[model samples]
Target: MKIEVNVKKRYFFALLGILLVLGGVFAVYAYNSNPPNPRVFGHTINEVDGITCNSGQAVTRTAAGWSCVNIASSGGSTPVNPVNTLSYFEDFIDRGDTSEVNHPGIISFQGYAGKTFGYIHSKDMFDITFLVKGNGTLYGLSSYESFYVGLVDASVSSRIYFFISGGNWQAGTRNGGSTKVTNLNTGVSIGNSPEWFKLRIKRVDAGTIEFFINDASVGTINSNVPVMPMQIFAATPGEADGRLHVLIDYIDLKITNLAR
Candidate 1:
């Protein structure tokens, strides 16, 4: 009888130890499976933080959650890479003056006194197609009334200026102090009426830059100096009290192998 009692006691203790071991395993598995939510950087913004975007940018809601897009400007939330083809399109249907750009290494000025001038950029691509509609009075003082679209570098030279002045169209490339101006077509007029125009600028080989308007070859610019296009921009230059505007329909860019 004494032997049987000792055996029963041992069995009970063994069962208890098994239950304790099972319970510990279950606890560890539960803890690991249900970890804490992740946080964003140093901010208090947890995974629950809502969507956010900067100037010249747009955001949309998706079934999974929030999604953001860099609309028309390369300066938006998306980074620019020019080794490949990059294109941007905008209708200006929403967010008027508030839709500005804050591209690095460029001045930040949206609309002042009801006139707008802004820039968009890509990586290092030289071939580009700039298309837009000129609407409303393109303002200016008497001698200097113009609206411009072209490429600009950190300095003034190494820049191409395609503009309309006093109802005449002009194309010019600048190299430091001197600017070579060419009258592509004369009597090209744009006023308050909405008129669509296109400027296609391409670098052919190492010494020549080709210009096109409305798919027609207007002229070519040959330069002995190497010019690297940094940013694609549009500006209304002058001092007219009238408010000016331009409708950006689309801009298509690609790095072409035609030079080779």
Candidate 2:
């Protein structure tokens, strides 16, 4: 009887010890899996930008004329990224704005606070086509993308297009074998150098669209509504002409549904 009692106690202690160890492990995993949210960097913003670049330093051709700009954010539940550079006169391209970027870099400004952009990446297919200029590296399409919200009052419309290689190899577009832009999905073409280029994304009536480079229609998209892709982005893939310099101007977005 004494031996039996001792054996039972030992088994209970061993089981309890194992359970405690597992619990600790689970706690650690939970903590590690969930990273903390991003906190505001500081009390004030101190970054320069080229948000609304001048019309023609590098843009000799109409299709290559693009004014680039840097982006910013507000800590007080403020809007960042998806900036309405043309809509709000305050957002301008500094002509001297460069910064680091990554996926999900944009947070919704006009929407309710806490609205953030997710990786609405394109599939291996489902793309529009575009053209490239100058000999340089042309990176792959971004499965992830951006979209702009056009506030319309009872449904207004605009024409949109895209050009990948005119403004100093600073644009991206997607296309299939056809040079037609509408058939492509995404394209990001550029070279690593200080060059000026032109690109146009014209959205027409929320349906017919065109992508132009240097005033030439390189591609077009025919859908029920315009793409109005809110974000323009690229990832550095391993390649030859290894270095690249890319830029994106503004998409001429027209609104029909206005609150006023």
Q: What's each prediction's TM-score?
A: 0.46, 0.27
Which has the greatest TM-score? 1
Model 1 C-alpha lDDT per residue in residues 1-260, reported as the tens digit of each score: 99999999999999999999999999999877733332111111122133334333333334664454443333222322221111221222122223223211111112321111223232223556655453344442122354566776555445665776666566666654355433354344554444456667776656667777777777776643335534556554333332333333334555422120
Q: Supply the TM-score for candidate 1.
A: 0.46
How many backbone collisions does model 1 have? Answer: 0
Candidate 2 TM-score, true structure as reference: 0.27
lDDT of all predictions: 0.45, 0.30
Angstrom error of the Cα, residue 47, model 1: value is 39
C-alpha displacement of 235 in model 2, angstroms? 5.8
Position 10, candidate 2: lDDT = 100
Q: Which 10 residues in a row give candidate 1 its minimum summed lDDT?
A: 39-48
Error in Å for residue 120 of model 1: 12
